[model samples]
Target: MSEADSSTEAAPRGGIRVGAQKFGTALSNMVMPNIGAFIAWGLLTALFIESGWLTGIFSGLKDPGGWVAKIGGWGEYDGAGIVGPMITFLLPILIGYTGGRMIHGNRGAVVGAIATVGVITGSDVPMFLGAMIIGPLGGWLMKKLDGLWEGKIRPGFEMLVDNFSVGILGLLLAILGFFGVGPLVSTFTRAAGNAVDFLVNHDVLPLTSILIEPAKVLFLNNAINHGVLTPLGTAQAAETGKSILFLLETNPGPGLGILLAYTFFGTGNARASAPGAALIQFFGGIHEIYFPYVLMKPRLILAAILGGMTGIFINVLFSSGLRAPAAPGSIIAIYAQTPSDDFLGVTLSVVGATAVSLVVATFLLKIDHSEEMPDLAAATAGMEAMKGKKSSVSSMLTGPDHSRGPITDIVFACDAGMGSSAMGASVLRRKIKKAGFDDVTVVNQAISNLEDTHDLIVTHTDLTARARQSTPSAIHISVDDFMSSPRYDEIVDLLGKTNSAEGASGSPSDGADPTSDSATAAPPAGAVATAPSPTQQALAVESIVLHGTATTRDDAIDEAGRLLVECGAVEESYVASMHEREKSVATFMGNGLAIPHGTNEAKSAIRRTGLSFVRYDEPIDWKGKPAEFVVGIAGAGKDHLTLLNTIAKVFLDADEVERLRAAQTAEEVRDILTEE
Candidate 1:
């Protein structure tokens, strides 16, 4: 099977996973990036609400006797004054900006905010859910309009058309939101609040976790907390000083219990990573940290459900509730949100739920470990191998073929540019500088804002298609793991070789030469080599394997290395070197390809700088990525760097990788490689 087919086969079937994935992505995109803002808002709500502890303390101090009275009066004023306006106006704009950015870009964000103002003005309650819906819709509509008029607009009228379109769309959306969407959503909000009130009054509130826990695991936690519970919680807090609805979804007990189970009872990296994850989940209030653990062992989701139900039951039994939403869902946030009277009840319920979940998760995990266990090293290798599959799937779907150009600038693009992509760009920048390619600029950008002027783009496999579509003329390199990809090293090697080749020919290029005494220095006479190009020397028809099989990354490397040996490219000892090199860093490049090579220490074992290509219809797991193509290299010095560059270009094109995988004969494979 091709890599794309294998990826499709690996995905969880049915509409459920698809729906869950979309919901999770949308919710996370709206909330995760603005966590700090949410925390600040929650803190303000907890401190300033009329019945809040701070507000009450300040109200008592309003009796004029001393500085305490003066300060207390000011505090009370601040709470009543600043909090209301913030929730009414600012909160919706924040939510709108995030949602709009997720769909379109900065332009979408501005329009989304404009539309959200109408929602905020039309509703008495905070229009959190309305902002979520309208923001993305506005952005999506604008994007569609932009795409439609992209090339049809007359010359010199582009900016005029773009600005007018955005303004007109924003105005229309805002009007629609006020006239239609706002009143409808306000009614829905009232109905939802009434339903929750009914459940709380009838003592059936605990049963809500039957839906909440499952949805939470599927990444709908933000939707439940901010969209449903927060509005209800605000109403209750105004009248009763608290609401059990807030605790229903924000309880950290269940996630903590699962992490605790894994920390102690789970094997390998799962156990090792669980302790840190547990700390982050409970104390840090990032419940997302434990999501992968639950996903990896889906049965563990039952633990979350039982624990959540237990916590809610205890909460309802004691009439416990929070004064505001717990923003981080951390223990600290929960405590901060709790009313004085409900503190003991909330703490008891949280602890009780934690104990229940821990017990349940421990049992489930023990059952999971009843079978054979791999050693730490082997398990770590297996984990990394599995981790790259998502990115690989992305590359397959979005063919990464972009026109080759002079690579003056490299961009690392992701859904959001501030996180992993930024780090990856920094890593590459440092590597490039170290290689003396100072003329080449490297930067990070959101996929939505990626410019065509960028000559090379590096992005996560999942974002590769978007990057390719945005900058089709730039060379694209997709990686499964951004932090530790060997592709960066490969790029540095390629640049160095290119610089040397250009220097020898006295040709100016974008990359600077490390060894050059002056910027414009020319190579001495007879510097150019007499040998055939690295491309011609590396690939041979004899070294190509049309059909190959390997269950593991190491096995795949060994198979490729054996092919090189059979083709007289390298000695038998070179296979061991290949494994040693792989042990240091994964060779899997996103887009269903892996390039395994030996360390410099094994350079003497190479008879020539040669390549062996092996195609695996049933892909071998390369770290956490599937590799349908394994290209083994036996290089002496920098002789094979040019060949590596050629291979990198071919792998960047998803269609080319598929075509190479489908080649029936060694001659076809050689022809494809030589065509580069």
Candidate 2:
């Protein structure tokens, strides 16, 4: 709409201009996804707050469940209530699935939905906790099902199977849940609810909300307000059986502040959204809808939080809530719920909070952008193009041995030679030593010299051009931030590829670290360091078989033993103790992957062995995985689990995953699993 927006329409083809445009574009991109998630959050929040447990807690305390507990209120029952342990439990899955469809299309949409649904119907913890834990399990299971469809069946058939399977599965799960698991879960949930009642009834009243509001405005309030309460309010809506966030709608104290200031101050889209956000929030409870405004100018967010908290405190101290049992505990809803004498309190909360938010937003208007945002028009075009090339992350990987490692040489770079690149290199060095790559040398230098051919050139956007000019053929890696650079998949891959290659060349027959200290010395000046070959990467995979007495816990020990002599991995002594049957808890990571390992004790004939390249036909929950394939590592002295910090990298890379997923044979999988 403005010159900034029009000129912004150009493509981000070449050169670096990560100015305000980049920041602005990045900020804008967050809105759509955030809104999608926020909508879902609202529905879930409402649902949980209205659950039999939370409501019953309030009911016991004579709070009568607030308007949120009333029928036809935002927290009213949805048709799905009786269908499972809860009506709102599946909201995230539904949202996730819908979101996936909108973003990724039909292929992975249902999978996301099904995966998210599983979290609700299956997990017993909080939404976020469940999302962190159970969410991936569901996704892993879905992937396996996808694998079968693609491998044994066909793509067309696979899609058909997936669609019907997901729908039918959802229904079947609901039915079975009703017959078997649902009641038990509901009963427990109810008991938990009573416990909540006891805690709330005896300890503190809803007064915490009032105080926490003011408390938030001061110190950690922004996080508590947005990161906690706003989301919590949104979740309340979901829990209450609403689709959109109605809670935030009624709570415009923070947003209104931003908007009113703009009306009284200058004009800009950033501040402009504030008024609209306030308007919508005032009527519909879409509180999170205003996040963009505050996020763009976070200094203003504190003011907004302060206002909201004050408003809430005063509202609670006085009057709030009215009419339809509002979702956000809005002033109207409070007024509706309060006695006639307390009506003034609700007005005070609304007006007071609005006044505060306005002042802060207005104050921010006179300031210039501390970090300029990218021009939206060109940024938008560039983003669209980049989205296509956002790079599935696999293509850039040149097998596992990406760098010429053994670390006699290390390079750290930054945009300005001081900021991020320098910081990133420091981080990489720390991680390197932590991973037992101690023999490697570390150096910090800017990318200014054209002839400086270091093993690896780590540079950020600011310093990348210098790095490029210096090392045209040198392995160049781009990083967004210094703190995050070393962790980037590409950087890790480049480093890991080389290390794995070095380790692989040590032992040709077995995957082990075979390199001697002398072999790792500096390469001759004229000698060219070759990139990793497929065979070298394949040899890098490590195998250890733990044949200890089967523990009642962790299946890792047993699996490690079987894998040690992996058809060809060798040594029956290494694998003998693996299956000496015993049952404690299963090695269930709740997915298809497992770390199945344990201690190998003395005075026992049992020896430990760990192996690789055996794919399970039917997935089993090994160390919480349904994984048929696993990378097993074992050590005799120190705790072997320590290696997980590094190996976890294998599990995290999208590129590595693609390669691993594509493997059909044990050898093919081995090629991917090898340390590289």
Candidate 3:
């Protein structure tokens, strides 16, 4: 979910909270998904509009004193001839399609586009704001009309009614857009443009940061940009070929400075994650990446506010503006949008803001470290205790009733169902395969499209309410971190146990038993007596560390090896051998776990098949992947496969991973590791 969804509340804030939420969601729906389209259009406008680079190139080519004057000067190139139609026609239809899709799916998108054309034709301006207002309005009306006649229409005439209803709705909305909404929105747009112009001219524009910075932290940046600033900026840009309003919100300098401060001062994971965020925010044009960092340390917002105000002050002082909107807010995009004369001024503003923000944030961070900082181990343990309490409460309320039957399908849901959710689902799917639960199917979907048919649903805590609303019957699991949810382990364990119970009954089930084929295989003489259960061979309480802290992958492997050595499981030289095996292929697996084992030559060091488990409070990057659990295995031969399979089963389960991560004691880790 975007920051906006989390911050928005039903209660009014400054009398605009609810309206801002709805408007912001709709506007962002139109623009955020189509950033590529906006970038293409912005780049085109930057190249071909009045006083643009392409226009300059054409003018230079047609200069009378130039060498090729014999071919005649091609005076007054018509750059607008290519750009004018896009703004008037194509932009509105895109907005309309997005707005309509938000309200009523594909059919609404079609009618929304059709209605937006009317707004475009009726207004001299680009009519972007008009498209936003009317497109959703048309989709909503079409949806209501469809609902009204959905079951009332005769069966034989269903197609006829559907077609005619859509046709009539499109016709009515188009006419209404042209005659009603278009003129009214145009007047409001002009008035808003005038007000912005007055503010810019009077040098009061820098104060917008007071509102913009706070709203941005709340994830309202997209709404402010696409809804309020872009329309006004477009109007001003049309007149002067640039607008300072474009710089008001898309400046990345403030965020860059804050991230830089965090890189220097933040503790543990915050410090580790900040540098990547800075690179992505400054170069990738994703300003939203920094919102969570500020949210985590709210006091840092003062730095952002000061930085934003400083940037605006510099911009206004230098009369700097961009020829078009910078969609991603990256430095590159901002420079591309900047006019030639304003490049130096824009650069100075960004640099000045970065400098101011960095100084202020560094001071704040340093002064804010008042208390004796808690160790990463203790902090993570405390968090796990809290999570345990919440889980216990949820368990008590629901009680132990497996009547929901075995879960055949699992869905990982999020706001967009694209990024975090998709990754979470992928991790679980691989885990299921590794655990030999081939019958289970895992997929990801947007919360809005979550279906009741799903047997289990996993989503972030913030999204649990929506997930429940969509699929209340499905067992709902909410996690604070999708990347490292321990609940997946529980699901895998539950399925494994259920399969065991069914196999014991000696009755064939719909799904194949993963262990059945292997269980029935005959063993050679004395093999059965010598073979040990995975738990007995691999795990011991002494080999487990619930709060291990390793700064790197090699450190983690070494720590795990030392544990096994202390338990008389491996020779001292085995650590180096494990490092060699890792070089051959890093054992870092998904779902926050890694298995580090020695190469085949190191078998001489192994006295028995033994495993050492180390859980880090602060995760280390194990070859580019965050690893919280490192399990080191020492095996003489094929005896380690049983232990590997057991560990895979535990790690693959999301719930089990959570349990292990949140385990408060070595006993808890041992129980979770060996229970199966």
Candidate 4:
């Protein structure tokens, strides 16, 4: 089961909320990739500016062309400093290029960087804002232009046309950026700067925390900090030595305080997990660890908001700010970016916020006297709902409990037992064996067949609710990708830790040798020739379709079903079941692929185990995600699972998928699927 399913089960989000998240994601994507450049410039500013620490260290030095004077952009050689050029040119170009790549690919990156130079040259101020705007715009324009002639050019003229088209489009976009976008964005930047100044002057800057804290929990921290604050903060830092904007969203105090509150006052799993979460939140700087806590009791958001305001108010009162943006918002990062004179102020701000948030969170938790333990899984679901994606870090709070005993029995559940579930089982079985956990047993089954006796239940995010209803006691892990999910690694690590802990008290179990001949023994010495396994007979060149014409998911599934029917692999009624299973839960597995299979109840329609493979020239929309490869499956017995596992292994590698996609003949496609 994959966690990558659409958030259809999450709370309803209006267009406004969805649009804001998408837009913010786009904006953050541009700046987040270029954070290294921002950090480099920030370090230079902190250490090399005229009032920097280096200048004070060499205060009495009299060398006019010394390294300090030359590097710091101070003394007699002030104009030659690298700091001005970095923020003015290098940072914005990097941002622009990254943003362009996000929209298109390498071509977009090239044109985006070229377009950014125009903005940098046109504006006297740093062009971070301009880069953000022009970079994606440049890429989008190139994408649209390419679409105009996509696949229309003569065979031999493609390279010539592509190169000249990019050159011409890039030239035009650059000129337009210089004459129009650059100056326009510079004005907007100034206006936004003045607004921040207005809020700061009135001592109401802390009020912004009301929005900031809530947004952070909703997974918009990166969008707010990198997209909005970093650009504004950089421009401000260029003028003054620092900007308070840098401290707004990066303050770890609020999150630290909430986790600390949970450590002391939280009950059940929430309390047990709080201490470790605090460590990650404060020092490791993953604020997401505490988000599920807030979602568990949404009123805790008030605690977070108040805590954030307290920190901002103290910073404002002391007129203290960091010289650069803190990437992770860790305590160490904050201190590193703090100017020497602002240490006391920064320390007090963190302390004050923690105290206030701790008090508020404690009060909230105490009043909720319900004996029922908070459902961290449900809260996690809510967080994912709000964020519109599964969070990799939040898994720590909801993962399998080692205290429940060793995870010996693991099961994978999907819409059908024979499709992706089997594939996921194979993937994890290999991983578990490699980690020397041969004592553990891994298997796959339909969600309806899930049993509470299992130690762990793995399922797609969409089927999680059903799996839980059927096997509520089992620790459930939801994933998005069956073949390559990080959860598999985390599970292995968890097993290692569990094994080591158990070893302290008793002799460890001598696990079964997975490689023993008994496990892989061949059939009895051949007395007579036998038929191949169902999986071996499943794929043929006749069953593989290249350059498929199915434009819609239903059409693709129907085509695949027709192939299975013609091959005598399944009855025609199984085709209808494939559609029925798809309606209940999409077969859109990740990695540009989908596996359309009949539901468990439709098993009687299958005459034999077989698979039909189809590769479309263009992507087919499978539940809003694109699917270029659709594998229709029918399994009367378990033999088909082996082929599905083989296919899963092939698709797991991106290079292999491309090779499969580029195959010119059905024979080539069949060879790729069946190859060892």
Candidate 5:
């Protein structure tokens, strides 16, 4: 296989399996918006049928009246049939609504109706599966309208835009039902019946079973892109009657994929798009929908093709002749559309085809081994290294590493950038002012993006992998309890060591700008200031050392919780509630730390939690049992997301894992952190 093919080879629910949600969403998107379009189509088809437009169009076009007679497959002795009605009525509306939801997140009822109307009025060309373009356009229209109203659309209207409602929604639906989808659906129902009867015929031929899937994928794409859409547009005109689609016998999608899997892999991703293709062609006769699967995983193309040829072989051998197009040999619609009672033959061919396709696709996946995907962290960490990560906690925990910046910059940054970093800036700023050294200035940026203007930068941890990309030679400091931890020590020492050297080496002639460095020129206005150590001291650092390590993670959390409760910082129920809630989803914020907290806490329980730090020797599942340490807190809600902000202050900025790996003792850790 080609390298691209090897890598692109590509969730299971239940019997539902992978791609079920995608398919279901697609179907829903197609069906819902088209409700109104269906009504319009039904109305038009009813009018045209009664008016004899089909007869005129067919006669003028030299196509047989029989084709027109079967537009909806519902012809009476003197009346036009249901086939015409269904074509005019149902498909567009149903498909449009479903399409809207799939493409657009949520929708309003009025919006959905307007979209359905647009489809009813505009659909003339085929789209995704050689079906209607109206469905997609309608969705697009609703999405556009929604964007214009954005926040203006109230919750009630937001629900109405894409959802079902009773008054206006029901009325619109009723109109569609009476005049659109009902008629077209009824007529399509007839066509489906006839198609089933035709497919039920034919003798037993084994090879036909094998050819179904590939034939469906390849030919299905060919049919929808060229065959079905040709006569409708100039873009399509060039390909008209040029392919096997003219035969009207092929399923036009990965019908062959099914057969190959059954014959080869038995159960694999090959079946992913089969269910959709079967339903579409069986009842709707729209193909090409399965192209995404093959486009996504090109390796399966040949396998699908092999299955198609095999299906044809088996069908021919069995003398199985389907009167109407059958997407999959497996679907009953194919059987229903057949002309023969050799129903047994059609059934066998379909089942065998699917089994074959499954086997083939499954085998391909096994051989490729490209299906396994990596987790997000590994992928993102590589990305982080490229982007340059800064340590937020370091600057906040200690003073900054800058000699050219002011403390307020650090403070503003704490509110908008990193609170801990800003706090450090504040400490450093006050210290500078108190010491009569009004020359040092502190700057704050995302720990992920620290600036070089500051004489010093401080952080408790080294986001070096993330920050190193942009932060070459910038001073850095490590601190304790960035949000509430001292692991950011690397930041403290590094910035401390480098700040002075960088400042001296800076050019006074670098630029006239206040923050600019010019080795031969003057420092910027309000630039230099001595950050106060007492201010850093004033910001209490509650270092909860191991105090003697615990055995497990939960026990550690329990101990931490006990300490927090003892400090009168939080209610005991908070811990239990958080644990119960966390079971549904994980709360292990990695780095061997389990930050189990909540969005809402009892007003009485909220407080500026001094600190609840516990250590563990053996990790237990904080949430997933992958735990080594945990810090629990309950900062007062009156402070507005205080606990959340506090948590963010520490963990978001520091490389806690690396720091813990280096930290040996609580006091050493504390001294290392608080000393700055």
Candidate 6:
């Protein structure tokens, strides 16, 4: 990695900031994976509840004798209705199960879920907060309990002891949660509910924006949105049919205003990108797009804060709220959740907040008389310093890091050609091409296939050592995300300057082929026969499972291995080899993907080259990373390499990944996988 790329390590990390960030991350992760469940409940509530939209449209659906009325959960059927049972039981259990799984995998998940039911029965209100508390606690306690007898049990009785131990411990924890943790969390929730009520009653709720807007720019939006606001908002919505809390953090007015200000008054790239960013922020509901604008000019944060406050004040004045969280905080989602009675208030809130932010941001930009905008790269670095990690979105807004030396040839390497290397190469290749850096060449190769020809190499942190061994002479960069890394832009910028400088001076290229030192190996001349395209049969509809049931990483891998085995790609023994390979090195390849395959030594178990794809509804923890897409490989030879590249091409686009995530049928997934 370049020195400039590693600068965030040298930045000061305040104790409180680190702690808050960690805690917030934990909370967000617990809830985020279960957001689909929340959304499902939200949709059900919006359509079937007593005052829901469907009833407003078809009054006959409200009659108790009708099947529609029964499904809508009216009166006598309230408990049986999808909406009530979903919010009260399904959502909380899912959150608790995900939280526990985060700590102790499947075992923790089981105990966590058992404990969550106790809390659900004990609390009168929706047990979201209670579930979050008890779920992780249950997992942690189970992990500790298991540690006591770990490796102590006799081999033959291990499974027997494991099952009974969980049963006994879960029983105790469920009782404890019901009698002890449940009421305590209820009290805390009540206190928090009262506090929010207090703020709204005093008409001082708008002041919260003073803290929220600044924190959001610091990259705490997920933490604030999914962690704190979601739980409280859900509770309030359960009682009142709608909650203002959902509108607080989600209203796009502040970001929209700031971007609009830049569109009119800002200079250079900031001005040029602002108009499109405004559309994305306001309509696309990607609030992150506008955060860079405030980050570039710190004073503009006041505009965001004022805009936030303006929106909140308007919502409060009109008693407007939403029935559910507006997930992307987009205007469309906001309106979809907004009560019909509150449309005017919600509209005015967005507009009023935007107006306030625009006026303030425009003023800040106008007062700065410098012909050129301030160095946005410096500001982005500062933002990274505050975040304690690199911000891919923020860094994309900045110019190239002047600190790194020039580079011409780069390779992205991964294990077995069945990982994110191809995807990373595709992304960086586009960036290099767009930047008009014809002299730069980027390629993807398996670490095992790498030669000492490249000047620079990139690999996942877990696999960097292998890459280094393959090409020790090259500078190696470790990246977490292959699809949307900021490194792509950095390299583009560095090469732009280097190529420009070299072209102006008519200097020789820095990218000399290292292979000139030895006689080149002759390419194989014979035509190569390969198995049918992996997508043709290897990754056919039967190999794709859109709604996978594996809750743990090992389970997910096992499922993938089983699919491969069933497809006659490999023997059953290859499944154990897959686990061994995972134990040796993380299979996580970023963009929520994991590729599990046997080690080189285990290739004897492979019968043919084939692929298996399993996409889970919730992410399974792959080491410390979360994986929603698990691809299993049983490669007999190089025939599957071409298919790997195609897989990379399919997943390289964010929109494509979202489409895959939303795919309902196995055929839909297969079609997406085979799309040109």
Model 5 off-target regions past 4 Å?
Answer: 1-83, 103-132, 149-304, 313-333, 336-676
Judged by lDDT relative to the true structure, which candidate is superior, 2 or 6? Answer: 6
Candidate 1 vs 4: which has more TM-score: 4
Please provide TM-scores, in order, for all candidate models, with all chains considered together: 0.55, 0.33, 0.57, 0.69, 0.29, 0.65
lDDT tens digits by residue: candidate 5, 1-676: 0000000011112232113333433443444344344334433343234234445555556545565555534345233555333443344344444554444433433334344553344333222222233334344555565446544555455557534432344355445543564445435434533443344343322233243334333232233322231112211211120112212234332444532333343234334334544455334544333343444455766655555555544555454544322333225544444433335555555555445555666677567665542222232222222222322221221233344443222211221132233333433433333333333454444433455444444542322322332343443333433333343334333334444443332333333332221111133342322332422222233435554354434345556666666666667665564443233223454455565442232324545533445556567654334566565544442121222222333343356444554577665444433332
**Which predicted model would earn the best lDDT?**
4
Distance from true position, residue 352, model 2, in Å?
5.9
Angstrom error at residue 465, model 6: 17
CA error at residue 118 for candidate 1, angstroms:
1.5
Model 2 worst lDDT window (10 residues):
1-10
Ranking of predictions according to lDDT: 4, 6, 3, 1, 2, 5
Steric collisions counted per model: 8, 103, 14, 7, 184, 0
lDDT (10s digit) by residue, model 3, range 474-589: 76666654445687777677666544443233333345433221221223433433565545656788888877766657668888989889988889988777776665344655
Once superposed on the true structure, which residue ranges of model 1 sit more than 4 Å away at CA? 1-14, 63-80, 151-159, 215-242, 259-277, 286-300, 362-461, 464-676
What tens-digit string does per-residue lDDT give for candidate 1 at 595-654? 776655566788876888888878886655777888887764444543444455566567
Each prediction's Cα lDDT score? 0.67, 0.41, 0.69, 0.79, 0.39, 0.74
RMSD of 3: 21.1
Among these predictions, the greatest TM-score belongs to 4
Better of 1 and 5 by TM-score: 1
Give per-residue lDDT, candidate 3, residue 254. Answer: 94
Error of 5 at 144 (Å): 3.3
Evaluate residue 163 in candidate 2 and report its C-alpha lDDT on the 0 to 100 scale: 69
Q: Which whole-number lDDT from 0 to 100 does residue 505 have in model 4? A: 29
Find the 10 residues in a row with the least total lDDT in model 4.
Answer: 514-523
- Candidate 6 Cα RMSD after full superposition onto the native fold (Å): 11.7
lDDT of 6 by residue, 221-245 (tens): 6667788899999999988888999
What is the per-residue lDDT of model 4 for residues 285-305, given as tens digits with 9 covering 90 to 100?
788888999988889999999
